[model samples]
Target chain A: MTSWMKKCLVVAASAAMTVGMTAIASADDVTLEFQQWWGVELPDGALQEIVDGFTQESGVAIELLSNPYADTKTQVAAGAATGTMADVVGLDGSWVYDFAKQEAIANLSELMEADGYDDSQLSDQIKYEGSTYMIPVVNFAYPLYVNLDILEEAGVEEIPTTWTEFMDACAKISENTDYAAYCIPLNTEAPNGIQNQFSSWLWASGGSLLKDGKPGLTDNELLANLVDYFKEMKENGYLSDGVEAMHEQDMVNEFENGRLAFMVDGISHLTTIKKESPDLNFTYAPMPKADDYDGKSGLDVACWGIGIAENCEHKEEAMAFIEYMMSPEVNAKLSQLANAFPGNSTAEPDYSENDELFLKAFEIFQDGYAINEFTGAPTAEDLMRSMNEQLILYFDGDTASVDDMLAATQEAWEAAYN
Target chain B: MNAKLKKKLTPYGYLLPTIILMMILLVIPIVMVIDYSLYDNVIANKNPVFVGLSNYAAVLKDSAFWTAVGHTLFFVIVSIAAHMIIGMVFALILNTRYLSTRTKGIFRAIYALPWMFTASVIAITWRMLLDPNGVLNYFILLFHLSPEKVTFLASRDIALQSVTLINIWSGYPFYMISILAGLQGISPDLYEAAALDGADAVHSFTGVTIPQLRPILISLIMLDFVWTLQQFALIWMTTGGGPVNATETVSTWIYKQGFTKFQYSMASTGAVILLIVCTIIGIFYVRHQKAEE
Candidate 1:
C-alpha cells in the first residue's frame, strides 16, 4: 500500500472512534422525554427555554415530545398501555384517575416525600384512592368574555351579574341586534364543551354536581334550573345557532369575529384574541350567578397537569424536573407565558405587562373559588358526553322535561361509575 | 430433498415474507382484539378478568350500539348508491365523443379534485362551507330561500345526510376513475353493432353499456361498501357523531368507547362486531372477484 493512503485510513479510524466515544458519553447522561401539548400552545421556544434552563442548572437534559392536545392524550394512553410511557408526561386532570387505577403513573406523594419536596405549596394535586398521582403546573379559569361593541349595539347598559339580569340583557341583545346574545358550545366531538362552558353555569350559581362523591343530577334542583335557563335561551333565539357542531375553537372564533356577545372561555385564549383581533373591545367578568345565590361562586378551571410514568427508568430525575417546573419563580414565568394562573400557591404571575383582560380575569378568578368536578373523576369525558347528549335532547324538545333528562344522565353516570 | 419436493415448496418460500408480515401485523393484533373482547377492563386494568361473552352481551343490549348500526347502514347504503350514480354519470360524460380530448382532460382533472385532498382538509373545508354563518348560508339568505341560516351539520335532522353527502363527494372520484377505465376498455364494436341495429341512445346504454359495465359496477360497489363502512376521520372531524347520536356510526362509537371512555373491552366487542360484518361482505367480494376471473 502507498504511504499516503495508509495515513489517511488511520486518520479516519481515529475520528470514527472519537465520535463513537462521544456518543456513548452523551448517552450516559440522563435525558427525560417530556411529552406534552404545551409546546405548540405556548409561544415558540418558551417550553424549550424552560427545559434548557433546567438542563443548564441540573445537568439533566429533557427531550420534548409535543403533539396537539387530543393527539397527546392518545399517544400517552397508547404508551401507557404498552408500558413505554415517557419519563415525564403532561396529563389532563381527567386522565389522572384512570391512569392511577391502572398503575400507569407513579404516586407523586411518595415521590415528593422521598425527595423532601414541599407538597404544601402545590395548589391542586390530582389524587386517586388516597394517593397523589399528578400535580397541576398551571391553571386556566373559564370566565365570561363580554363584547362591548355588541352590548352597545344591543343597547345593553350594564354587564349582567345575576341570572335575571343576564336573561334580560340576552333578550335585549337578541331583539335589538344582529348578533346572538350568548353561546354555549354543545359539540360532543370534544365533549369538554359541556364540562367547561355548560356546567360552569351550575357551578357559578354555587351548585354541586356530586352528592357524596356520586352523581347528584337527579336530586339537584340547581342543575334543573341551569338546564331550564339554557332551554329558555334556545327558545328565545338568544343562544348562537349551530352549537351542536361547535367545538371550543369554533366558539372562540365566533367571539373573535364579533358574532357572539358573551361566552365562558379559558383565560389562555386572551393572548390569541388580543393578537388576532387587535381592535376587538372585550372585557372579562365572573360568570353570572343565579339571582338568589349569595355564596362564593365556583369558577370552572382546566389545568396543564404534569406527572411521572410508573415505568420511568429515572424517577428521581423526573421528580427533579417536576420540582423545577413547580418552583415559585419558574411557575410564575410559565404562568405568564401561557397566560394562565400559577399552580404554586405562593407563585403569582405578573399581569402588569400582559393584556389588561388577563389582569381583570385574574381579579375575577380571585373573587371565585376554582372548581372542576370532572378532574380526577372516572371516565370524565364519557360522563360529560352523556350529559351533553341529554342536553341536546332537552334542547330539541325530544326529552319530556329537565327532570327526565337529569334522571337519564344520573342513570348513565351510575353505569359509568360502577 | 427430492427435486419435486423442492419445486413444490418454491412458491411457499416466495410467499414466506408476506405470510410472516400478515401473521405479525394483521393476524396477531386481530387475535389480541378478539381475546380482549372476552375480558373485562382489559387495558385500563392491570389484571383483567376473563368475562366470557358478557361484553358482547352488554354491547348488544345497549341502545346506542343499535343506533350506531342504523346510522352505519344508512351512511354506507346512501354513500355507495350516490357514489355509483355520480361516478357513472361523470364517467359517461367524459367518455362521450362530443367533448374534445383537451376539454375532457380539463373536466377529468376538475372531477378528480376532491380525491386529491386529505381527509382533514376535506373535513375542515366542508365544515366552513356548511357552518351556520358560512358561504352556503350567505347564498341561501341572498336568494331568500329561508328567513334564517340553515345549520347543515348541527341540525340533528340533517347531520347524517350532510356527512353522507360529504363522503359521497370525496369517494365518487375513485368510482369515476375506475368506471372510466372500464368504459375505455369496452369494445367500440358493441356500440357500433347496437347503432346498426337502430338502437336508440337509451336502448344502447341499457343493452350495450350496462352489460359491459356490470362487472366493474359490482366490484366498485363491494369495494366502496367496505371503505365507507370503516369511514371515521371525515365524520369525526365534521360532526363527531353528533347533534346527539344522529350521526353516531359504529366506528365513532368504538372510538369513543376505547379512546374517550377508556372502555377497551367494550370497544373491542364493538370492533369485533364490525369485523364480522365486514368479513361477511369481504367473502362476497372475494367470491364475486373469483367468478369474474
Candidate 2:
C-alpha cells in the first residue's frame, strides 16, 4: 500500500471501531424496543432519524415496530396474555382502557415526576383506578366544522353555540341552501361521518349515554330532550334525506365540495381539509352547548396517549423515549404530523403558520370538556356506540318517536353497563 | 397423465414439490379457515375456543345475516341473468359478417374492457361517477332531465340496485368474452347447414348456439353465482351496507361484524352459512343439469 493510503486506512479503522463501540454500548446499555401502530406516522425515513436521535442523546438504541389499530390491539392483547410485550406502546385512547383493565400497562407517575410533569400541568382526567397509566401524547376534540360559504349562502352571520341556536342555525342553513345541516353515522362501530356529526349535539345538550355507572334512562328530562332534538333535526330538512346511508368519506366529500353546511369532525381532519382543498372557506367552532353547563363550553376529548408495557425488559429506556416524544420539539412535530395538537400544555408546539380559522380550533378547545371526564376506559364509549347506531334514523326523520329511541338507547346502555 | 404421475413418483417425484407447495399454500389455508370457522377467535391467538354450533346459531339469529343473504341472492340472480343475456347478445353481435373480420375482433375486444379493469377501481369510479354532486348527476342537472338530484348510493331503497348495476356492468363483459370464444370454436358447417335449410336468426341460435353453449353457460352461471356471493368491493366502496341494511351483502356483513364490531365468531358463522348456502345451490344446480344430460 502507498504511504498516504496506509494513513487513510488507519483513520477509517479508528472511525469504524468507534462506531462499533457505540453500537455495542447501545445494545448492552438500555436500548428500549418501542412499538407503535403509527408506523404510518413515521414517514419514509423518519423512524431511522428518531432512533438515531434518541440513541445519541440517551445512549439507547431504540427499535420501533408498527401495525394498524386493530392488528396492534389484537397482537398486544395476545402478547400480554401470553407474557410478551414491547418496552413502550403507542396505544389509541379507546383501546387503552381495555389493555389497562387487562393489567397490561406500567404506572408512569414517577416517570412523569422525573420528567418534570405534574398534575397542575397534566390533567388528572387521564388517571384510571387512582393511577396514571399513560402519558398523553396527542389529543383531538370533536367540534362543529362549519362551511362559512353555506352559512353565508343562508345569510346567517354566526354559528350557534347552544342547542336551540344550533337548531335555529340548522333550519336557516337548510332554508338558505339545499345543504343538509348534518349527516348520521349508520354503523354501531367504525367512523360513520353522519353519526359522529350528530353525537356532538346530544353531548352539547347536557346529556350523555351514561349518567354514573348506570344508563342514562333514569333521567327522563335529558332523554326526552336529546331524542326529541334529534327527531326534530331529522323531521326538518336539517339532516340529509337519509344520512344514515352515507359512509365517513362521503361526509368529508360533501363538506369539502360544499354540499353540506356543518360537520362534526376532530382536530385530525384540519390538516386533511387544509391540504385537500386549501381554498375552501370554513371554520371550526366548539361543540354546541349541552344543557348541563347551562352557559359553559365543553368538548368531547379524544386524546391519544402512550403507555409503557409492564412486560417490557427495558423500562427506563422506554420511559426516556416516551418523555422524548412529549418534549416540546418532538411533541409539536408529531402533533403537526398527526394533524392533532400537543397533549401537554407546558410547551405549545409551533402553531405560527395557522390562519385565524385554523388557530381558532385550539382556542375553542381552551374551554373544552372531556367525553367522559371521570372514566378513562372505552367500555362506556363502546356501550354508547351500540345505541348511537340508532342515531342515523334520528337524523333521518324516520324515527318513530324520540321516546322510542331514548328507550332503546337506555335499554342498550343498561345491557352494556350490566 | 403419465408425466404428471411420473413427476409425483417417477416423473411424479418431480410433482412432489408442487403437491407439497399446494398443500402448504392452498389446502392448509382452506383447512385453517374451516378450523377458524368452527372456533370462537382465531385471529390473534393461534388457539381458539371451541364453540361448536354457537357461532352458527348466532349467525342464524342475526337479522343482518338474513339481510345479507337476501342481498347476496339478489345480486347473484340479477348479475348472472344480465351476464348470460347480455353476453349472448354481444356474442351474436360479434359473430356478424357484415363488418370485416378484424372489425369484429376489435368490437369483441372493446366489449371486454370493463372486465379488464380491477373490480376495486371499477367500483371506486362508479362511486365517484354516481355521487349526487358527482359527474353524472352534475350533467343530469345541467341537461335538466331529472327534476331532482338522485342519491343513487345514498338511499337505502336504491343502494343495492345501484351497486348491482355496477357489478352487472363489470361482470357481463367477461362472460361476453368467454362466450364469444365459445362462439369462435363452433364449426362453420353447422351454421352453414342451418342457414342452407333457411333457419332464421332466432332459430339458428335456439337450435345450434343455445344447445352447444349450454355446458359453458351452466358452468359460467355456477361459477359466477359462487363468486358473486363474495363480491365485497362494489358494495363496500359504494354503500358499505348502510342507509339501514339496504346494501348489506353476506361478505360485507361478515367483514363488518368481524373487523369493525370485533365479533370474529359471529363473522365466521356468517361465512360458514354463506359457504353452506352456496355449496348447496351449486350441488343442486350441477346435479340437476347432470340428470338432464
Among these predicted structures, which one has the highest TM-score?
Answer: 1
TM-score of chain A of each: 0.93, 0.78
Give the local distance difference test score of model 2: 0.71
Q: Distance from true position, residue A152, model 1, in Å?
A: 0.6
Instruction: Name the candidate that leads on DockQ.
Output: 1
lDDT of 1 by residue, A1-418 (tens): 8999999999999999999999887666889999999998999999999999999998899999999998899899888877899899999999988888878999999999999998999998999999899999999999999999999999989999999999999989998889988888877788888888888998999898999999899878888999999999999999888999998999999999999999999998888899999999999988898999999999999999999999998899999999999999999999999999999999977777888778888888999999999999998988999999999999999999999999999999998788
Q: After superposition, how far is residue B231 of candidate 1 from its true place, in Å?
A: 0.5
Question: iRMS for all predictions?
Answer: 1.1, 5.3
- Would you list the C-alpha lDDT of every candidate in the order shown? 0.93, 0.71
